[model samples]
Target: MADVTPNVSLVATPEAVSFLQNCQLPVQLNAMTGNPAHYDYDAEINTAITNLQGKAKESATLVARLTQDEVRTSPLKHQEASKLAGRLVELAEGTQRLLTSKAKGYMDASSDFMGKTFTPNPQREGYYLRAADWISREAKNGEGNGYKAIREAVTEDPDFAVAIYNTSHRLLGLPKEHAMDFAEKAVKAFAPAALDYIEKSQRLDELAKRYPAFIAQVRSSYFSPFELAKVRTYVEMPS
Candidate 1:
């Protein structure tokens, strides 16, 4: 844990406003920009993620309080409380964006020691292969087609999109979840592809039917010639 992280191990709602008052954006931003060679990349990234999650959770509690019927009846107080709650969420989101942008620097700097760490290797194209394999296995077992459920739920309950996404994010951090490992590798292998997927589609179900072709589509459309060449080299390398 970072020296600045709060010592409290929390449960239920964070009733205290100190966390909001103490949420320092500049400190969080600067923490991500340092050379990652000196730190454990996996630990540092997890810490950053946890911090963001904490802020969001705290903000959620405040949002709940603001949304309570009693608070809603008082217009000025309601507006002020809502504004403060929104600020906490905004702070968390800004920190997330800055950290993701800083990740390439950290990963690149820490590449030499990756063999000894749990951090995913960005240069490996086999990551896509792993994701393909995992998805295929999931399909066979009838566990991976939840994209339809996700889409339906997202459409029917847009207010819960963040909650659903957060559940997926938690699953990604689970210790034995190799799907996340593969996905992380694939993302670093071709982040633009992942971003494009996030921006353009929610149809993981349809794509899974022809996974290889889908992968190719993402690769060809989002990756540069040089990056494609590197991926091809990695693909053809003897494991």
Candidate 2:
């Protein structure tokens, strides 16, 4: 007296079809135990679950590559991984929103790290501020805030050469007599860290020329690495 009817509507893809075929075998085996009439419906649901599992496995592979450190270090690889990571995070978030319980469990089981990366929160504020400061500095539109931010970054990380360079360069635009001492200090602080100290010294020389008195003071004051090298070169030159 069992109603045995296959539901055809549930078969959507090749994976789904394969899933339903395998699922039906189990239901057909246990037909005499319970719910013989709904075996077809159960088979369809299992088919959908199996198809979802296949898709989840594919996405998980991409997510794994994105969070890997070595992949993020290379410019080309990082760009590609970042895009894939963002997409996977978005997919996880959207799924979580539409199907809270099911998607939540799936995400918890499949990719907890992806879930955390996708969630928006204040932990990312520092990264946003750092990016904004860099953009403003490069655009040369918000010099005051940009310089201030760079200075703060230097305070937090003394070895930050880029921040030191920006701070010193911006300080050069201030009143010559007032900013000279700080600019000299910045140059000294940054000299060892810079890739091209000669170029930096040339730039500072141009700024120092605006105030002859400050130039004299810096020449007589304790010589910075660049200044000492310049002085030694002049001393050795044949006059």
TM-score of each: 0.26, 0.18
lDDT of 1 by residue, 174-234 (tens): 2235334443443333343444333222222222233233223222222124322333333
True lDDT of residue 94, candidate 1: 52
Stretches off by above 4 angstroms in model 2 are 1-53, 60-73, 101-239
Best by TM-score: 1
Q: State the local distance difference test value for candidate 1.
A: 0.36
Tens digit per residue, CA lDDT, model 2, 1-239: 01111231011334433333332343522221122232233353234334433433453344333334343323333244344334433443433233334323333432343223223345655554464356345435344765565445443443333333333334334333423433334444533223133333333233223323322221222112332233333335578
Error of 1 at 77 (Å): 4.1
Worst 10 residues of 1 by lDDT: 3-12
Model 2 scores what on Cα lDDT? 0.35
How much is 53 displaced in model 2, in angstroms?
4.4
